[model samples]
Target: MDRPLVAVGSVIFNGDSVLLIRRLHPPNQYKWAIPGGKVELGERLRDAVIRETLEETGLLVEPRTLMGIIEVFKEGYHYVILDFICEKKGGELKASSDAGDAKYFTLNEIRKLNVSSTTLEMLERFWRGEKMPFMITEISK
Candidate 1:
């Protein structure tokens, strides 16, 4: 068995609303999610999220603290994610090729927003504001 043990993610927030970006890529089209992606080789964790956010949303952000980490397993593959709490640092709002759209939304909106199961779960846990130990789980059958 092989485990895919590498990836990064973020939970960018604007006051009560968290920023969600629509994936412009295949498979996740029209679906919403936090602005993040996989960690590149030799890239720092924070730097990877920062870079991914800018590339996806065109907004520079300074990540604060790592909120949580998730391990999703399905079909013999593992997805390791680092969910960070970040704030806008600079740059005018612009959507890029990776993200079809970007905007902030309240937690309630998140409940109504269409997103990947992992993304939605991460958002809900983040909204609670509890300092939690990095949560790790395997989404399996």
Candidate 2:
């Protein structure tokens, strides 16, 4: 793509578990990651996160805090992703849209899954309850 796409992702939490989805699309196809997708033109970041989460995981969530920003570049495509810590509001858990599977996992369970390095770092911060300081990460596939 010519320009970087703006995307939003949510690290939805309920107690000690967090939401994860097995992506059915490229960039991380078949791999587990937080629910999210590209932000539509004129859409707010918070709205994008909520919409993406619902589209991928069938969950309605309320974004609580912004976790951080990640910049990913691979094969001529670039994306600037904003990640948020969200709380479950309502809706059933099921895979939909770009997700092949959607489920909740404890931190220990997440450690054993096939996930992106960026996601791992974000999870670590979330688990520790670290006060994220608007971090910017770059990932190259």
Candidate 3:
């Protein structure tokens, strides 16, 4: 059996808007989601979130809260994703690396986009200012 891949994602906020990326690859390709990606070996979770966010959105962010954890299983791939709420520290907004596009969006604006269900749920909870406990999920193959 293979170990599940570990990933990190961030809900990075700038004022009343949140940063989002249009994925350039599979597993919801072309869909809008928070900036993040797989955690490299030996990387800390917080560090991974920051690095992934920077790589995808060109923004330096500070992870403020551990919002939740979600397990995604599809086909033969399994991933454990750590989700964080982050504050922008610096850097310009430009899509690069794993993202096709990146931008900030208000909650209402976000609802108009094509997004993953998990991402939508997370955003809704975030907009409500709900304190989330750690969560785990397995996507049926």
Candidate 4:
């Protein structure tokens, strides 16, 4: 059986500001989520995260720590996303057509925004250096 997992990163800054995007797809349309995609074959996890962020959000990133891991069951597939806490290296940040728009936000503001439940939980666990386990959670259909 496959591990059914992939590593993901969330670039955050200033203790409260996190990089978010407005997705332009079926899964997360109009919701503010982290600027990351999937881990590519033969690519390093760090490279994948940075590349995905750049491609999706136009921001160069340097992930600092492994925040936590989250398992999501969505759209008839299981995904394990390794959430990384990151900092910006350098880039002129903008939103790609893949993601509607990119911006930074405070913790309170992000909490009020339409963020995915898993994303919010990941941030919460990561903030306290707590560990999360592999478990199933149904996604919004």
Candidate 5:
């Protein structure tokens, strides 16, 4: 890894469910996580989150709130991820880009899947009615 890359993720909720994608790339391959990717140069954080969500899950999203930051370090890769709460504005749900699968899951169902810890923790926090802008650090061995 070179310098830490900046990325953005969106947490879209529908009633009691949350949207997740199965990653097709390394660092967390095959793990269910929020739709996201590294930001392109000069792109705004909110735009990156919206674009990434659409690219990965085929859902057009409108970012509603800044959820928090997640700093991840694993396998020599580092990412500073800005997470946001997003609302689905349009488009159908389907896997594309670096996502192998995409779907909405209730918290109970999510606990049974191969979900990223960071994602699981965040959802748990959200469900518990915890405060926003939670800070998280994930260092994988």
Candidate 6:
């Protein structure tokens, strides 16, 4: 990688559950996380969130609010991720794109799964109704 890449992701809620995808690639492959990917060139951040969610989870979503930002550095990978809390619109839910699996998980279920650290922290802060646009930094070997 040359420069810090910008990515967008969504935290979608269906009733009391949140949607998540098991990534099929690193920097956190095979672990459940929010559905999103790298933003495309000239794409608006909100548009990227919507598109990424659809691409990974097979569900259409509308971005509701900017939850926070997470910067991750691990194994020679760096990603500055903007996460939005979104409202589910429509479309059947399935795993696609770089997602090995997709599903809605309750908070209880989430705590039991092998989730990306950023996802866990973001969701925890969100559930606590913390301030918006918070920042999280995670570095791993």
Give TM-scores for every candidate, taking all chains together and pairing residue i with residue i: 0.84, 0.92, 0.90, 0.82, 0.96, 0.95
Off by over 4 Å in 2: none
Candidate 4 lDDT over residue span 68-124, tens digit each: 666776655567776677787888888995799888887778789998887776666
Per-residue alpha-carbon lDDT of model 5 for 44-91, expressed as tens digits?
988898899989999999999888788999878899988899989999
* Model 1 alpha-carbon drift over 4 Å, by segment: 26-29, 74-77, 136-141
Sorted on TM-score, best first, the list reads 5, 6, 2, 3, 1, 4
TM-score of 1: 0.84
TM-score for candidate 3, residues paired by index? 0.90
The residue-level lDDT of candidate 5 at 60 comes to 94
Q: Where does candidate 4 stray beyond 4 Å?
A: 1-7, 128-141
Give per-residue lDDT, candidate 3, residue 84: 91
> For candidate 3, what's the RMSD?
1.7
Of the pair 1 and 2, which is ahead by TM-score? 2
Error of 6 at 88 (Å): 1.3
RMSD, every candidate, angstroms? 2.4, 1.5, 1.7, 3.0, 0.9, 1.1
TM-score winner: 5
Write model 3 residue lDDT over 1-141, tens digit each, in one string: 379998889888778888889998866789998889999989998899889988898889999988878788865778888889888899898999989999888888888999877777777876787786557575866
Global fold similarity of model 5 (TM-score): 0.96
Clashing pairs in 3: none
Worst lDDT run of 10 residues, candidate 3, spans: 132-141
